[model samples]
Target chain A: MTLIMVVDDDLDLAEMLGIVLTGAGYEVDLVNRGDEVMPLFSTQNPDLILLDVMLPGLSGVEVCKLIREKSMVPIVMLSAKDDKQDVVAGLEAGADDYMVKPFDPAELVARMKVRLRRSGGEVNSDLTIGNIVIDQIEHSIIRDGRIIALTRLEFDLLVALAKEPGRVFSREELLSQVWGYRPATDTRLVNVHIQRLRSKVEIDPENPAIILTVRGVGYKAGVPGSFQ
Target chain B: MNSPFKAWRTSLVIRVTGTIVLLSIILIYLAGSALYTQISSGIFDEKLNLSISDAQSTARNAQFQLTFSQYQDKAALKSIFAEILAVPPKTFDNTAREVAIFSFAKTKVRFKFSGASNFLEVTSIPKDFRKKTKISNTTQWGRAKLSYINGRNEPAIVVGHTLKIAGAGNYEFYVLFSLEQQTRTMALILNYLWLTGIALTFLIGIITFFVLRRLISPIRDAARVAEELTAGNLELRMDINGEDEIARLGYSFNEMAVALQQQISRLENLSKLQQRFVADVSHELRTPLTTIRMASQVIYSARDIFEPKVARSAELLVSQIERFESLLRDLLEVSRFDAQAAVLEIGEVDLTALVKETIDYVHPSQDRIILLLAPITPVIVDIDPRRIKRILRNLISNAMDHRDGKNIEVQIKESENEVSIGVRDYGLGFTYTDKKLLFERFWRADTSRARSTGGTGLGLSIALEDAKLHQGEIDVWGERGRGAHFVLTIPKFAGGSIRSRPISAQPE
Candidate 1:
């Protein structure tokens, strides 16, 4: 059974989420306030986190940052605001994905399933893009013999791009393939995550050598020493 | 471009100034003519008086000298005449003196003594003056031309007198006075008058322009500051100097500005409060509504076990709640727009994909009657993706709802500065007047119709507002039974305005 921890400010919505998740064959642990999230989080070690952006004690973005400091937990932000700032801020704060208010329950579960699934797991391999070496098995990037930190979404984005180095990945392609999004899902998600990835892997983010942008198209991996 | 002359044609200041200049020119011309006539008459009067006196004295002296000669021989008379003529006529510089003695036409003479004495050339007198002098033998004086033997001309006054000589019989004596000095003086006076008049007029024009501009500067500044204040720069105020009437006006205007600022800020605070209340109500209601939705869905899942009527009621309840939720969302969005708090997060995206997605969302069935059209390459544009998606979604969904089982065509086109998407539906179209009210909130094409498949009724209005936010436009055209077309034109890049609409409302 999949254990999903749901943190929300409203008691009834938390209970409702628990009911909905339980009915979907998932064990749900309901937490009402944001401050109570970590204590329950450590012991339970839920596979996924359904966090609300606006909370009474600590904001969902802050909790996401705190959780990101310790583990690579898959965190999904639940927000009433579909506004870009809130969504991007949550993503930048280390949320894997987000769902706006009044979202369908079935869709939410499908998003969670996508977040928890691991890629390149059956066959552990090391991938290199530009100067950075990506260890899929270890879930880390080594550049200049130093390990760099990356959010889960950024890691997935990089892995997806690196796996198909020859293919030119358009924003829509990255969105659908990596983010598990349908067409017309906000393209800002792919762009923000790509920027986050470059800052982590590339020697100079201002002049990205790892993810080379194709003019009038999308992005592709740099050919060997083309960056030089 | 407005022509400079045409710009002045409608200006009150130019018209008034032109009228003033024309009237002053007319009045000045009248005064100048009168002054010229008076000066000329006075000068001629002084000239005539001096000329007549000088001529009379010379004539008397010549007659006395001739009468005193006793020998009466021609030689003696001629010598006396020469002596009398040798005394040049004492006259002003402008007066030329000349003397002519002519015997009466009927006067006889001694055979050897017919020599007549004339002191000056007869050509010194004008032919016209000589004709009048010939007609009237009495002493006469008038202005005439005096021409010397050298052919020099001077305006002169001729005064003639008749004398009777002892042996020579009747004689005519005349004096011609030159008016050269008077003419020079009159020319100098005319030059001075012209310079003075021109200088005075120029001075008046300059002084008037500056004085009028000085008086008008405060008003112009007041108008500028007032315009700035109206533009919402409430801190603006007219620059005040010494406490003249204009300064007093500034003081009063500042007072009004303060009042206006206070009133506007007060109203602004009130509006903010109202918006906050609406947002709070929406948030507070939505949380509970979400719980209700979940509960109702759970109940709806097990509806097969319940009675048919109860199951139908449960289904209806679920659908109505979803409708209520969409309405609440739209209302909140509209309120946010009203507060001018809507923000854009811009990114580059292919609009082709967005349109396809919207069509799928509207009609999930594979046999959708809608057609998606695009260019060979991606129609990429920079914009706030979420807003564009919402707009596209609203327009496509509305088309599908009204398509009335007919095919719908969605077209995408682009230009350098703008992009347009036209959604054409071959459905029950609208009337001419319906287009005007199409974007009104909660308006329906037919009131008797059912709620139209879970629409919030604010979709088109919200779409229009969204388009307006991006400095875009949504053009609509519809006929009774022909079809309906809606085209949304936006700039190709964020923060740009649409200059060329790739597609128009008219059918291709």
Candidate 2:
């Protein structure tokens, strides 16, 4: 069974989330304070983390960074404030996705399912995008005969791009495809994640080649075997 | 040159200085001419008096010599006349004087003598002046141009007197004093007067310019500071130094700035606090709302196991909660606009595609209600898509509410700088006066009618605010039972103003 960790300072809301997640057939671990997340997270080794931006002991963004330093677990942040700066700050701290407060429980569960799904059962396990080769079975990318580690979200994003080499995917399409979001919403998520992905994969992140951006459209995978 | 003319037209200092210089020039010219005329006329009068007196004495000497001399025939008389004429012309230091003698026409003597010194032309004296001199008998003088045989001319005072001789007939004696010296003096004086006048005028102009500029500098500073203040530099102020009138102006200006800045900052603080309170309220309410929402959903999921009435109540609870949540969202948006805190998240978007997507989102049915008119190619514009989409959704939903089962027409048009989206409904239209109150929050056309749709009542107001944030506008046209048209015009670029709206609210 997949396990999920929920972190929030508000005990009632955390408990409520626990009840909802358990009802959704996922085993749940509830942590009230942001500072207490790591110890329980290490022991539980949950598949995903549900973090609240405001916490008592430590801020959610700081905790997010600390978690990112140690693991590649998917994190979806819950923010009470929908200010652009707050949302952007949470995303920049290495969160995979974010939902404003008072979100529908069914929708939250749907997003968590997308984040927890394993990339398996592909017809072709190996794919080439530009000079990088994505090994789906191994769940890694090989660049210049060396393996490059990527978070599961980045991996899914890259695979989605490589799956259709010639297709240009809009930000909305990528959000629905990679993040399982319905009723296409904010594009900042796709923008920030693209930057983060380029920083990890591209030789020169300033000018990206592996995932080329199409002006006024979206992004596309660079042709295989092309030298930049 | 054009820029300077524009500056002259706009700047107070330049205009004042130019006017002062022009007036000073006119005044200096008048005074200089008056002074020149006085000095020149006085010099000519003094020279005329001296010439007449000198000719009187010479004419008396010649008459006495002719009366005392003894002459028997015309030869002795000629010798006597030659001796008298042998007196040398006056030297240059005294004045360039010449003498001429002519026998009277009525003389009875046979031998008539006529001679002039220095080759002076006899015709140099005017006939009118000669006649006056002959009739007056005393020395008479007038101004004349003394001409010589060599075609040289000098301004002179010609004096004449009648001479009596013993044997020779009556003769006319004349003395001409050259006025070249006086003319040169007058010319030099005139040059000095002109130089002084011009220099004085220039000096006055420079002085006035500097003085006025000095006086106006503080005012200019105040103007510049005012501009900066208007441009949002509230800290700017005039620099005050002393206690003169101008300095007092500076002090007062600075005081006004301080007061204005303090008032603005106070208002800004109050606005910020209000925004903070609104944000805090929204945030605090959201957490509990999430909990309640989840609790309701949990109960809603288990509604099938409950009584029919309870089940129905659960369904209503769920739907009303959704409505309440939207109302809260709209309230927060309204407060944000009130605090002027709304910001644009700009991006390049294909407007036609966005419009089509919005139409699909608002009305998913295939009843052919909305007919879209758009360009063949995509219309790309820079805008905050989220806000724009919200505005479109509001307008389209408004039309849908009043569409009265008739087909709705949605059109998109573009200009060089702006793009417009229009939604027209052919349904139960509003009154001409109702258009004014349409964008008001919570305003309904018919308060008696039960609204079938779940509108927050703040949708149109929020849409208007959203358009204003983009420096855009929404115009409404409606009449009783004639349907309604709503058009939103926005700039194609961020921070650009709409010009020449491609779609007008009034339909053709």
Candidate 3:
């Protein structure tokens, strides 16, 4: 059984979310205040977090950052604002995904499933991209005797590019392959995630080598021995 | 193409100054000619009087000398006549005065002996004047030509008189006075007059130009300031110097600017207030609406446990709440558009994929009401996905609503800078005239027809605004009983303008 912690200031919404998660065959832990999330999160050690943006003591974004500092657990934010700033802010704070309010409950479950999906690579799996070694089992990247930390999404993005070094992938293809999103949608998800991934993996985020952009088309993996 | 005349026509200063200069030129010329003629004629009359009296006195003296000579012998008479014709020594002074005489023989009148002092040519007298003077005993004067033996001629006045001598034959005596001195004096006077006229015209022109410019400068400034104000610079004002008519105009213009600024600021404040109210209302309403919607959904999950009536009521409640939520969303969008502050978050995406997504979202079931003609290659572009999605959702939902259980077509096409998505439906089409009013907010069709399609009435209007924000447009074609078609064309990039629509609203 998987444990999911739900954080919200609104009691009824929090309870409703608890009921929905319980019906989906998951153990639910509900916290009303944002301040109460951290203490309970460490003790309960839930598999996932469903946090709301607006909270009484701490914001959902701040809570996401606090959680990201310690753990790589999947964090899905629930914000009433569909505004770009709010969504992007949550994503930048290391929240894996977000859903706007008044969203269908089933869609929320589907998004959570995408976030909680396990990477299918075996422990002995080794991938190489642009002179950087990616150890799938250890979930770490090594470049010239230096180890780097990458979130699950970023790691998956790198692997997706490294797995098929020759094939060029558009944002739509990456969205479907990495984020499990259908092709019939906006590709900003791929854009923001790719940026986050590059900032972690690339030595210089300004000029990326692992993922090279092809003008008027899409992006492709750089040739082997390309990273400097 | 630009002639001086044409330039003058267009320029206010040149037109006025040119007209004044032309009038002054004509006036000065006429006045100058009249003054010149008056002075010249007066000087000529004085010289003519002096010449006439002097000629008469010389002729009388000659007659007296001749009578005394007649008493002597023929040789003495000839000697006296010769002495009378002998010219005095030539002087350097240019008196130009000379005397001439012609002696008539008693029986030989055909051969006239004409002699002149200083060898002045006697034939210089006009033939007409000589004939008249010979026939008539009166002393006559006429303008004459003075011919010297050196072949030079000068204009002169010749006064001719005939004397009936007692012994000598008939003698015609005349005096020729050169009018050169009088001509010089007249020329000097005319030169002064012309100089004075030119100087006066220049002074008048300068005075008129400055005075007119002074009067029109304020007006010109006011016109310029007013033009700037009309061009949307509301802070500009006319410079008021004194309490004159022009200053009064400046004051009034300033007052108008003040009023205009006040009106614009007031309207802006009012619009800001309205936006605030809408934002606040949306925030306040959504909290409760979310709770209600979720509560309804939660209750709806266990509908099988409840009675059929209650279960059906719960379903209706849930659907209506969803419709109400969409209404709230549309109202908020319309308010944002009205405030002119709706911003576009542009990203590169495929229109074909977007259309497919909208179809799936609107009609998730493979129902008979909808059909799609999608593209193979992705029509990639930079656009605000959320807004375009909203517009497509509105358009497709509209198609489904009025679909009249008939099949629909969603087509996508692209051009270089513009991409067009057209939704066609073979259903209860509107009248040709109503097509124009279709984009108007809250406009409904046929009160008699069934209101089966639930709409907030702001969807089309909002969609139109979304297209306009992208510098795009929507064209519609419809007719009664025929299918309705709507085409939306937008540029490929943010801040780009639509050049050519890939698909037109007209049926092909």
Per-model root-mean-square deviation over C-alphas: 4.2, 2.2, 5.6
TM-score of chain B of each: 0.82, 0.94, 0.74
B214-278 per-residue lDDT for model 2 (tens digits): 88888888889999999999888788888889888888888998999999999999889989998
Model 2 chain B poorest 10 in a row by lDDT? B445-454
Q: Cα lDDT of model 3 overall?
A: 0.81
The digit string of per-residue lDDT tens for model 1 on B1-508 reads: 4776775685445555565666666766677767877887889789889878877888778778777768557777667656655545435642456666555565564312222223344666556665566567677887777665556677777787777677667666676766777887788877777777667666666666566668878888898999999898999988889999999998999999999999999988987887777757766777788788888888899899999999999999999888888888899888888876677767777889778877887788988598888887888888777888899888887777778889999999988888999999988888999999999999888776527565777988999999998899999999888779999999988889988888989776
Collision count of model 1: 4
How does residue A156 of candidate 2 score in lDDT?
Answer: 97
Q: After superposition, how far is residue B97 of candidate 2 from its true place, in Å?
A: 1.6
**A1-228 in candidate 2: lDDT tens per residue?**
989999998889999999999999989898998889888878899899999998988999999999998899999999999988988888888999999999999999999999989987655668999899999888889999999888899999999999999999999999999999885499889999999999988999988889999988899999987775
lDDT of 3 at B92: 62
Superposed by TM-score, candidate 2 places the C-alpha of residue A19 at a distance from the truth, in angstroms, of 3.1
- lDDT measured at residue A74 in model 3 versus the true structure, 0 to 100: 85
Flag regions of model 2 displaced more than 4 Å.
Answer: A224-228, B86-95, B106-114, B166-168, B448-450
lDDT (Cα, tens digit) per residue for candidate 3, span B1-508: 5799787876677678778978998899899999899889989999999888877887778777776554456567556656766746345666587777776534444325677867788788888887777878888899998888889777899988886665445877777788778877887998899899999889878887888888889888988988898898988988889898888988988998899989998998988888777767775676667668777887898899999999999999999998889888888888888887689887777778778878889999966567777667888988888889889998888877777888899888887888899999988889977887888887877643524567878888999999998899989988777878989999987788987888989997
